[model samples]
Target: MNVINKLKETAVSVFPVMVIVLLLGLTVVPLDKYLLIRFVFGGILLILGLTIFLVGIDLGIQPMGERCGAELTRKRSLSLLLICAFVIGFIVTAAEPDIQVFGSQVRGLFSFVNKNVFTFVIAAGVGIFITIGLLRTVLNISIKWVLFILYAILFGVMIFCPQSFIGIAFDSGGATTGPMTVPFIMALGLGVSSVRSDDENSFGLTGICSIGPIMAVLLYSLYLKSQGNFDSSSVVQISETAEAVAAGSPLSQIFGPFEEISGEVLRDSVISIMPLFGLFILFQAFLLKMTARQVAKIVIGFIYSFIGLTVFLIGVHGGFSQVGSELGFALGSKALSNGGIWFVLLIAVGLVFGAVIVCAEPAVWVLSEQVESVSGGTITRKLLLVFLAIGTAIAICLALIRSVAGFDLKWILIPGYGLSMLLMIFCPSMFSGIAFDSGGVASGPLTSTFVLSFTLGAACVGANGNDSFGVIALVAMMPLIAIQIMGIMFKLKQKKGGQK
Candidate 1:
């Protein structure tokens, strides 16, 4: 029954994307039959995989993270807490499927980047910042000051990094906070905050953690720039790869990627979970005195999480990505051939895609539920979802505009982030934290994968050589502004009610 309920919910979240794609094929896009079939198959897998994954998160990941957090913090050793937090953040991030997916894309596009090095650098960034976030929570520092200082430094560093690296760096921030990282990290934050009896602080850990990767990648990009003599000739345009995939593979070749990816995903999933499992065991032995039954349940939960994660990765990588690429190429081609109406059509499609695809993101649901729970239902899940969808929809529109117009990303990003930081002044502090965290959560696995692939394809064809790296960055950013706006509204409503 629980599994069935989860399936129904997951289906609702996922089916809109499938419906939109089918509609596109029937009308404007006209996808290849085989590619469309693969997309449908992948959607089925996505619904199923996401159902199981959510169940596993509830059963194992959240509980375990909360327990570990609370117990670790109870020890009252700041040094120990910071060290453990860093390790947890690093291990979870290193194992994150989203980062792995992003890293693979990066490596494919740029010959100079080593996937392992990139992943490691990103993981280190999350680790360092997770430590900083915890320190802020423990010390009760202001989130606004912390955010202002970090981003100011980020912008300073951004000026020094290569323009190409900027988009990838910002996208890295979003990708690091995917399904594998968000639940555990949010739960862990909740647990830590519980120890301090402070609910507001629970919301900002992921926000702070998101900043780490952008800074780290920017700094790493500077290092790469310093090296100077790399071959630029080997760079593979994302559109080329998307075009190849969009062109359609043989019937035999279609499932072949699935077969190959399943094995690889299974391996990666195990590796991803092991460090956390090992940490749990270490705590179990020394700190987390659990009964045999409790331990058994958690062990089973880990197994479910591992299996679900593997399946989810396969569904995403092998299935939906091709369709996204294909759709983008088709749209891009249309815009090239037929200008005015096609551009409007593309923006409309982007709005719908941005709004719906976010629904399918597991981390978005987790964060929404957290917001509702933490606010004691003052902020309903449905309300937050609406805000997120609107924010995401707007983000996609901007991305489409950028791709179509060939503007520098800084034009959108500088104002977007500036508005977010500025809004922190009037927005309730709790909402400020929630808003920043939502910014991270809103850009999860699907944004990094499908939405990103789509943008790359569009940029390849539509913009005549404009870079396609910043869509995810924009997707990650818009929610900060949106949610903070919601916060200000909520405050005004409260004031109105008091006056009445």
Candidate 2:
């Protein structure tokens, strides 16, 4: 699709969020003028960035990933394909903007760990899991069994890890599967799976790869604990503060957020694309040599992607996060004032916020559109979006509950994933993969930044520091069940039609 068309689509996704926040500010949680202005500008930036990013994915990243996957499969050398898969997965994930945000957050919380080292650990996990996913497709193994075994291992590791790390590990998994990584990885999966004449295997690689980070983080946490290096008291307090815009012309107030974030956003945007750019060049030279014209088109796409991603992150950080946090704090304080009776308000608002926010997630758009395309319209994008939104809403409610109640992460995640695994028995195979993949995509950059910041804001009201950490984790988990349930119904419908 053209950029204009993508812009309109993104506008529809983003404006609801702006409207909701505006209404909340006017009625229940009044935000100051400066913050609201920034939010409006942020929405505009989000629309523009998401539009350009989608176009770039179509023109550049998806094609390259698919071609690389297809070419590797055709080579008929398992060893080479596995090695390349690991390298691609590792580098691409390391460059993912979402992972960087997550790593930095963890680093900010615990100054003892270096952000680079933490990100490296997360990237290594992705690389190893990508290899396993590719191998599963090649060996024609059932994703259900693979998922079962992987989650079993995840839970086993979760037992010994510290409370602080549990949420971070799951959030890390979700973060790795963000805008930068989802399109390319999903395309790569399609490319590899296309080698087989079946559709079932095409949808699960992202799902499988998401598992890697969770495992890796959990193991790292366990190791930290074993060495007695973890100092729980050293963790920094999580809170949000909206600084005043610089005193100057009116234009300064309008442009404050953009100006504040430009430098870091530019640097991250460059870092985010470089690894993938280098990998694409390697593939072009070795595996999929194309004409000069094709090369130029891909290069143009990369440029678009870089610019789009930079603008998107700036918009999110500049506009959405502070507002979300402010609103959450307002609501949380109100809830507290009423002797905690206002917890219901948290659930209701969280549901609405979660529903709309997931739609704005760039990766959600990518995954939904890709699902429809890959399934030849059998599984509609609207269907995927609806299910994802529902799942995300439930997840937000759960996060808010934890924020107020201060429950253990195990109580929610363990049972939630257990149910997800059980649902796979009744779900169609393709849907199983799609559902798992949806979990990752549902909790993209917007969830990590906006939704998560909102949850943290509420948690801070009660001094529930650790409660907010797993919002992304819950956001990632719900889709596994939602999509699987949808898949079961779809399967039943097919059976009924056959009987008729």
Candidate 3:
């Protein structure tokens, strides 16, 4: 029954993307037979793998995170809470596939940013911020004030960080809060808040925690920039021929690419999960010991999570990467050659594509469900989806425009975030938290894989791919304003009801 429901959910998420690709193939961009076949196969794997992965999260990871959070809070020791928070945040983020993907892409473009070092810096940021978030909940600090101060510091740091690092830094905040991190971190937040009688305190930890990576990456970038050690070349070239690699036999073609990725993903997953598992065991042994049956169930859950993650990563790398890159390249190259009308059409397609793709993000579903539950259905999943979709569409349109026109990312990010922060003054506190968190949630695996590839393709043709790095950052930023507008409407409605 659980599997059946998850399958249905996954289908709903993936179907629109398949339809969009088919439309593009028929109308604007016709794919070669090999690329088309790979896409179809990849889409199938995405649905299957995502369904299994989400189920595993529910059965295993979420429960364990909640228990860990609950047990840590139960101890009533500040030092223990901070240490555990840092450790858990770092470990969970280090294993995140989105972060890994983003790091690889950046390394491929700029050889100076070592992938391992980059990932570790982002992980450390999440860890420290998570510690701060936990402290806020325990001490009853206002999320709004915390966010205002942190973002102020973030913008100040941005002045020193190189232009190349700015977009990547903000994008890291979104990417790290992906499938593995969101459910567990959110569940952990709930567990910490559960101890508090106040419902208001139940929300905002994830929102605050999301800020950590942005600041962490920005600070690291500033440090690197200060050392004057890296190349400042803006003329990076993407190979068109790279997208046309020959396909193998049908079976081998479908399964071949996964061979190397499977081993790497499996190793990363094991390394990412074992520490948390070991920590849980230690905590159970010494602090909040559970019954034997409870331990057995959680252990089984961990196994399911590990298997699901391995399969999911294989599907993403094997099925999605090449096709996404190729499609973007094809569309982008065409748009560049055929100017005027074709440029407008390309932008329109980008907007529609962005709108639809958000529905397919697995993390978006988790977030929408949690929001509805927390808001007592005042913010329905459908309503939240609309706001997110619209925001994503706008963000993608801007990204496409920027790729074509060669605008500085700071121009968009500065005013866009300024408006978002301004909205917080008028927005409800809970809505403010959800809005900021949604910015991160909306840019999950699908954005990293498909939308980003599409943007890079456009960047390759329209400009040097230097501008492409910021597309995901734009996807992450726009939702804050869109959702906050919705929050204002909700507040108005509530006030009207009160007056009545």
- Pick the TM-score winner: 2
- Give candidate 1's whole-model lDDT: 0.84
Q: Give the winner by lDDT: 1 or 2.
A: 2
Better of 2 and 3 by TM-score: 2
Q: Which lDDT values do the candidates have, in the order given?
A: 0.84, 0.86, 0.79
Ranked candidates, highest TM-score first: 2, 1, 3
Q: What is the lDDT of residue 102 in candidate 2?
A: 78
List model 1 lDDT by residue over 10-87, tens digit each. Answer: 898889889998999878778777777778887888888887788877877788888988988899999999999898
How good is model 2 by TM-score?
0.96
Give the top-scoring candidate (lDDT).
2
User: Cα deviation of 205 in candidate 2 (Å)?
Assistant: 0.7
Clashes of 1: 0
Better of 2 and 3 by lDDT: 2
Candidate 3 displacement at residue 226 in angstroms: 2.5
Q: Regarding lDDT, does 1 or 3 come out ahead?
A: 1
The estimated TM-scores of all candidates read 0.95, 0.96, 0.93
How many residue pairs clash in each candidate at the backbone level? 0, 0, 0
